[model samples]
Target: MKKYLFYVLSFFTLFVYAQDRQLSLAADVWPPFTDIDGEKSILSDLVQEALGRMKINSTIETMEFAKIFIEINSGRFDGSPALWISDEREKYYFFSKPYFYNQLILVGKKGSDVSAASFDELSGKKIGVINNYAYGDFDKNQEVEVVSDLSNQKNLENLLSDKIDYMLVDALLIQYMLTYQLNDVTEFLAIGKKPLLVKSSHLALGKHVQNAKIILEHFDEKIKEMIADESYNRILELNWIKADVDGDGKMELVLGGNKAGTSAPQNIYGLMHDNSYKEKNPPQRYYVDGKLYETWDNIPNNYKLDLVVDSTPSIEDTYIRLDFLD
Candidate 1:
C-alpha cells in the first residue's frame, strides 16, 4: 500500500508540472470584468491573483473576440480568463469550473413592463444585443427583431432614447456600475427582476496545452482558497456576496466591509450560480462569527448596519467604470 501511494503521488506531481511556470492568455474588451488593456479589471484581477497564488506567472493579450479562438487553436495563446462554453468548444478547450457569471437580464425605461418570461412573449419587440454574442436561440425567433451593437454603451444610449424596447444586460456590469459610478443614472433605468439568460464565466485553456487538466484543477482549488480567505471579495471589490464561508453546508451573506445592511440584500452576488441551476430556491441561511442566523430580523443589531457607498466610486475602490458611453 505504501509503495502504491508513492507511485500515485509521483504520477500526480508529474502531471501537474508538465507545463512551464508561464501562461499566455487572451480576451476581448469585456469591460469591468475584462478589457484589452487589462487595467483595473475585476475578472483580470481575480485571474491574476488566483494564478499568482499557484505561482504561475501569466500575461493576457487583448484582441477582437473572434481572434481569441483563432490564436488559441494555433497554439499562439494558452487560454482566456473569460469564455462561455459550447458543444464544439469542449473539443479544444479544457474549462475550469465557473468562477463567476454573466447574467443577462432585460432592461427597459423606468416603469416599463420588462417582465416577459420568455422570448415567445417578447415577439415583435425590438431587443438590443451585442453582435456575435451567444444569446442561445434568442435571435432565431422570426417575430423578434434583434438589433446588434458593438458594445453595451451603444445599447444603453439607444434604450434611453427609445430606439429599442429593451436591452439585454449583464448583471455583473450593472452591479459594477452601481457599486462605482452610474448610481444616479440608474434611477432612469428599470431592470427586470428575472434574468433572461444566466451564463457562467470560466477560465479556459486549449486542450493541447500541457497538463491543462491539472492546471485547471489547481486554478479551481485556488478559487476556493481565495473565497475562503475573503481575498476573492477583496479582489472583486464588492461589499459582499452570498457564500458558505464556514464549512457548515449553508450559505451566508459574506461581507467585505465592517457591516452589512439590515434587510436581506436583494441581489447579493453568488460566487457560482450552479447551485441555483439545481434548486430554484435554495435555503439561504446566514453564518457569522461561528453562529448561524435563520432570519434577518433575528440577527443582532450590531451586525446589521447600512452600508453606504459613495455617490462617485474611486479608482481605489473598484474596477474600471462603464460610465455612460460619455
Candidate 2:
C-alpha cells in the first residue's frame, strides 16, 4: 500500500511539473522591436516583462529568421516572436493575439520615375525582394521581375548598384538600413506611402507543444490586459515607434472616444465582407490544440471575453463556450 501511494504521488508531481514547464522562444534581430544587445532585445525585454506579469518564464534564443521558422515547425523550439501569423502557419502552430502591426513598402533611389501608385503599375519592372518573402497579393503577379536573395547586406548593395530597379522591403528594415547601412547615402527615398501589405506580428506556439490551446488562451488574455492597461502602447513608445493599437495601417488610437472599437473584430469582418477590407489572405480559424473546445469554456470564469458584433455576421461575432464533462 505504501509503495502504491508513493508511485501515485510521484506521477502527480510529474504531471504538475509538466504543466508548469517554461516555453522556448526564437527570433531574429529586427531593431527597435528586437535587437541583440547581449542577453535580450528591446522587444524581448517587453515580452519578458509581460510574461513575468503572468508568472510565465520563457527562454529566448536568437537565430536566423529562416532557421527560426524551421525549428518552430519541426517542434525543436516552442515558437518565434514577431512573425506575421498567416493561414499557412496556422496549420502547424497556434498564434497569440497580435501585439503590433507592420507594413511592406517600396524603396527606390531618388530621382527615379518608377511611379507605382498601385501594384499593377509595377508590372514589367525589375523588383528586388528578399527570397522566401511571402507577399500575399503581391506574389500573385507573374509579370514583375523578382530578384531574390536581396535579404543580405551585400545583395542589397548589389541591387542598389543598378542590379535591380526597386525593392519591396519591410518599413522596419528600411529604417534599420537608413540608421546603420546607408547613413552615408542621403539620396534614397521611400516613395509613396502605398502600403503594399499590412500584417500583425504575433507570438506563435508549435503544434507539438502540450496544452497549446490553454497556453494560447492564457497568452491572449495577457495580451488583452497589456493593451487595456497601456503596457503595449508604452512599450512601443519606449522603443521609439508609432503605436498601432488597432492593428490598422494608420497609427492612431482608434480605441479612444469616437474611435473606440472602430476596428473591432466584428466591424473588421464586416468590412471584409463588404470589400472594404482588402486583405488578400482573409483571417482564418486555426486550432492549435489537438482538440477543439468552445472559446467561452476555454476562458477562465474570472475573466470576460469581449465579443464584437457587425452589420454582417461572421465567426468572429460568436463567443466560445467550452463544454467539458465534470
- Strongest candidate by TM-score: 1
TM-score: model 2 vs. ground truth? 0.62
Error at 227, model 1, angstroms:
1.3
lDDT of 2 by residue, 175-199 (tens): 4444343533345543434456566
Question: Candidate 1 lDDT, tens digit per residue, 1-326?
Answer: 99789757754763466444588999887776777562667888899888887777888988888888999999999999988888778888999988887778888877888887678889989899987766667746789889988778788888888889899988767776665556544677788776777788889999988777767877888887777666787887776677666656666666564565777766666666545523567546664434567866776888788787556656533444544533
Error of 2 at 143 (Å): 1.0
For each candidate, what TM-score against the reference?
Answer: 0.83, 0.62
Clashes of 1: 0
Q: Model 2 residue 101 lDDT?
A: 57
How many residue pairs clash in each candidate at the backbone level?
0, 4
Q: Which ten residues in a row have the lowest lDDT in candidate 2?
A: 317-326
lDDT of each candidate versus the true structure: 0.75, 0.53
Give candidate 1's TM-score. 0.83
